[model samples]
Target: MAVQEMKLREKSAPARVRVVVEEAAPPMMPVIYRRLSAESLRQALRKMLLIRRFEESAEDAYMRGLVHGTMHLSIGQEASAVGICAALDPTDYMTSTHRGHGHCIAKGAQVSRMFAEFFGKEDGYCRGRGGSMHIADVSTGNLGANGIVGGGIPIAVGVALSMKRQKRSSVVVSFFGDGANNEGAFHEALNMASIWKLPVIFVCENNGYGMSTSSDRSTAVKDVAQRASAYAMAGRIVDGNDFAEVAQAAFDAVERARQGGGPSLIESKTYRIRGHSRSDRNRYRTKEEIEAWLARDPIGAFERQLLRLGFITTADIDAIRADVEREIEEAIAFAKASPAPSIEELTRYVYSD
Candidate 1:
């Protein structure tokens, strides 16, 4: 009987396999023509390209020993900066992280002046006093980029409080990294903003690493968005490499804040192709990991999407690249030619002056 049972079990027909077909994820860009106009798409592409070029130029200058201080380049995170800024009104306020040149550019700052600032010229923003990490443009509504980790979060909340007190419809967007999420200021600011119903959007650009430490090692929560639940605010995770995804999420968050819906946390999953800063040798990450992300280059992927949608031709993309290159060269020339800050003006803008 045992032999017979074993034979039956061996001869039994293979169990029926069930294959579940999961629904495909949504496209990076909206399919409806009316939802995203060709002009707007083109502008997004241009803005992203400009940022990439500007960062490349800055990196080159730094390598040549032209720049005195260190700079944090947002080489692989252009989509996050451009997409979020594109969703904002010109009058809307934004606070930036140390890696904020892209934020300044997306917020309508001129590359010439930015270059001048990096070169420490008198014509630069902040009159050349604030270098790469501290560039600010009040006219463009950028409060300033903070050098301290998690420093800008509180400042953004304060700005939102001020806006609320004034009854202004504008919202504030705060850009910070995954590392900042672990800071005491992050929790305090978010709690206060939530309790007060401040009009603020806390955007976490989770680029996988905080300096040499991986976020997995530092953050208690797997997804930064999960923290929003503690504060009873809306939280969303987005593909930071996709411009359309980031833009859509940003639009909704901005609208919510403007309508007094209080703060929303957006965690954009992006990667920094470059090291944390110019001084980093990139010994922390594997070469294979870097190659994998480089293949998902946001700008290249977006260009392909634009071509496929017939919004732009190869020629159009080439022309845009050429124009941006020319602009970058001109900015470099302008920065080099600009005079340094005068000794007489050294103490001029200081508070004690």
Candidate 2:
């Protein structure tokens, strides 16, 4: 009887439960990492590097009196240009601001032809007519860079309207600065686009200033993206220096627009390390702020991210740098050797052919 009772007690004992906690699957990579091929990412890094080197070279040239007239340099906003353009099709159109070298290059303009334009040579996209601030490569679908603040916004809206009427799948990306956000054209264009459900993307490269004036002093809204609500469109704010973030936002907006989802606004919160223009003394901001932003160099940050993701090796980066350097040197040589437009032919393109 006692043996039976002991057996029953043993049988009643609770069974040990084994807890198997499978290590949580590594956090899902971002949309860009999953969507873009390795080659595409490498190309992105290459373009970022190229923009940096090109801007630096342009600055040096301006200082040496090789380039005439005042120019705005997109020295620190490389990622915003590259990331946004990466999401665009070759057939799509783009409008640029005065600070638009990066945009031109990102949209597939050749550095040689661009250099020729800067040199005012006949080989330029504008046949030596439009220089730095007005470089336009129609073959690459770049309408033109606007010297007037907020000028491109209305143009983009019009282009979008045209596309809608034609039933074409192409979209237009209008890139402007923080200052342009306050302009009347900005409001008018967005309202019209939203009402028509036009395929357009309004990208505000908000680099903390509209010329020498800080945006906080000039603008009412805390974030430029907040303005999109008035137009009943999507608005997103991203770290413009982070390529992945900018690209992801652009990709979403582009896809949405392509699907007839109407227009979207992306306010890239970036900082321009350089002054407003070649002549800006940069008295409005402190040296410490500039230094801090310099530390977040978009090219360097993107390079590091690429390395971490194993998309690029040190050797590859070195090779890309060498190649871009050689390319720039060749471009400079080509520009110097190209012929300038003669005075007799200066007014050739002023009228319709």
Candidate 3:
């Protein structure tokens, strides 16, 4: 009976064995798309649009003598501002540079109040005391915009240390320019932040030229992010014009910091299409250079990306533009209608109450 069973088994095609292999899982989504919703992305685009339009309107207002004092217009670097801020929670804190109107708007400041600040009205974020360079909205977690280069870096370090002491899960972002990278404060702040493992993100908005002195002419290192090694921290560089790229880098750094992984140095390679300040004649650069940067406009690049991704249509862009225009008009009207800080109380906000 055993011999007969063996012969029967052998006759059944030798009992062939099959091996199964599973295919690899589909690639994970891009960081921005994975972490942020479609609505968040749309709001990002809207914020970028808001920054661009607001800057243009502010320039017009400045030209028409409606605004006083020189203002640093961020004209072409909207993506760097809005993209980085998109990764932040409303509770997270940030400090800005002189070129910070974009930062203010990206952090959820009302354009009407921003315009009011620009107009030096009483309803402004600083109650007209800060003006264009000193806009601060503590309620929105914006520490303030620093007129001094690299000034915010140390401030951010202190804030981060405070958060650590209190055991808060918040992080502080210090937004500076390429010019600030050379400052002594920057190195000291980075070193301290790294040693203490503080949650601070040092964002260098390297817009090629630091007030007409090209970074190539000023910075010893090819890229500012390379400086991270000195402080033993993570360093990354992204095309500051590409909103998606900027958002991804910022999100990764933010997450790392929030999780107690320490600080990061992100160098955003962007260009400012406008002169450094209102008084700049732009003679330090050429028309061709300006045109090249303008062609690579951050807002336009982001808009194109949104349209291609089906996040927004041309009509959506048009409607957003219209909505922003109305908002700007309304902001200007509000500023014009708002009262100015009284002369008798000129020192009202000078000291902490």
lDDT of each: 0.86, 0.86, 0.85
lDDT score for residue 37 of model 2: 95
Candidate 2's displacement at residue 153, Å, is 0.5
Error of 1 at 138 (Å): 1.3
- Candidate 2 local Cα displacement, residue 258, angstroms: 0.4
Winner by lDDT between candidate 3 and candidate 1: 1
Off by over 4 Å in 2: 1-28
Error of 3 at 115 (Å): 0.9
Please give the TM-score that candidate 2 achieves against the real structure: 0.91
Model 3: ten consecutive residues of lowest lDDT: 1-10
> Which residue runs of candidate 1 sit more than 4 Å off their true CA positions?
1-33
Q: Count backbone overlaps in model 1.
A: 0
* Residue 226 error, candidate 1, Å: 0.6
Q: Model 3 off-target regions past 4 Å? A: 1-30
Candidate 1 global TM-score: 0.90
Error of 3 at 158 (Å): 0.7
For candidate 2, give the lDDT of residue 211: 91
Summarize candidate 1's per-residue lDDT along 5-107 as a digit string, tens digits: 0110011222121112122234344643346689888888988989988887798798898788899999879999998997898899999999999899989
lDDT of 2 by residue, 131-165 (tens): 99998888988999999999999999999999989
